[model samples]
Target: MTATTQPLHGRVDPAALPRHVSLADTVGQTMTMAWRATLKMRRNFEQFFDVTIQPLLFTAMFAGIFGGAISGSVDNYLPLLIPGLIGQTVLTACVATGTQLREDMDKGVFDRFKVLPISRIAPLAGPMVADMIRYFIAATLTFATGIAMGYRPGGGVVGVAAAILLAIVAGWSLAWIFTWFGTVGSSAQAVQGISLMVMFPLTFLSNAFVPTDTMPGWLQAFADINPVSHIISAIRDLANDGAVTAEVGWALLGCLAVIAIFAPLSVRGFTKKM
Candidate 1:
């Protein structure tokens, strides 16, 4: 009888592997993943429809349909409609994040990602960071459409910039909730349906397309309490009055709260799937 010993050929040294990824490493990996997501967006140009065509089309349709009815003229409605459209567009753009995330997960993209030696949060956060570009595009086009339609913002350039920044931030914050949904949802279609269900009420029920005072008492109360309403009001104050009011503070606070709550939840849910 003979005993045989196995050779250690091509064996990996356990100590050679990174014990803990550093902060800088995590950030770098996140940025790398973000670049990948951006490249995907560029390749699939249709992914940009929500940020571009939708904003322009909706702005025109709403202005044409409701402008004269609400504010006596399209020009008069620009100030209110533009800000509301910015919020709506940004929120709409955010829906794609969850839908795409679910699609990727279903396609086994995240399964491949699970084997990579990078920060777990990077996969979830990267696409979200890349989505900021869509938010910016939607916000910019909304403002440009308003300007083209003779909607002069009294808040000037600085005010408009602030409003755009607010819209992007708010959109990014709200996206975390959808990302969490994507992490838990069974399919891309399911996530899209859930996102739309949440978006319609928040957007339409808010003071987005019309004045809250004109609404019934109960609806007005809901609109006043809606976070979307606060964000839109903040945008209006910044773009129409050139002022940072308490609404701006509330909007930012709400964004922080959403990120605080949903970001962790998304990460946890994603980890469970992994």
Candidate 2:
């Protein structure tokens, strides 16, 4: 018997692969991934419905329905309604981030990412960063809808801008929690359903729609403690008075706490999946 020898085809050595990347390189890679996500959103234009159509529709619907009943006039209610709707819209917009992430994972997209030489956080953070555009859209449209409905803000342009900025920051911070859910969820639908379960109580049970005083004593107690209440109140303070109050500081502190907790959990969960 004759022994045959095979020639080595050019294959990379596994041991030679990079184990760590510089911060600059990681940031560059993250930006590249973010660009990819932006392109995806462009192609899937309908994905903007939550940020665009929902804001316009919900703002009109709520203002029309609750305007007279809540504050005696739509004009009078706009200040309260606008801020609350902005918070709700931004929070709802964030739900899509997790659903899409779950879908990508289900479709084995993350499997492809496993072979790439990039920071694992890039693929996760990129889509989140890109989703900020959606948050901004939701915030802007909510304000525009309020304006078109004769809801003038007292805070002027600077206060309105600050309010939008706060919503975006809070939305981005909350998205991390949902992103962690996406990493572990069984399906896209499951992630969305779970997110809604958590969001409905936060959005509705608080002072978003009605005054906490109007609610029952026990429910008012819960609403007072809810973090969503703090966010909506903070936004209202900025949009109505253009003042940064204790509520705004509390909202920001809550955001920082959320990031400090969920960011690490999300990274750990995601790495395990990889």
Clashes of 1: 0
Query: Where does candidate 1 clash, by residue pair?
Result: none
Model 1 agreement with the true structure over 1-274: per-residue lDDT tens digits: 9986645554444355565778998899889889999999989999998899988899889999999999999998889899999988888888889999989988888876665677878999988899999999999999998898898999999999999999999999999989998999999999999999999999999999999999999999999999999999999999999999999999999999999999999988997887
- lDDT tens readout by residue for model 2, 47-123: 89999999889989998999999999899989999999988988888788989998998888877666667787888
Candidate 1 C-alpha RMSD relative to the actual structure: 4.0
Q: What's the TM for model 1?
A: 0.92
lDDT of each: 0.91, 0.89
Over the full model, what C-alpha lDDT does candidate 2 score relative to the true structure? 0.89
**Model 2 spans > 4 angstroms off:** 1-19
The clash numbers for all candidates, in the given order, read: 0, 0
Per-prediction TM-score to the true structure, in the order listed: 0.92, 0.92
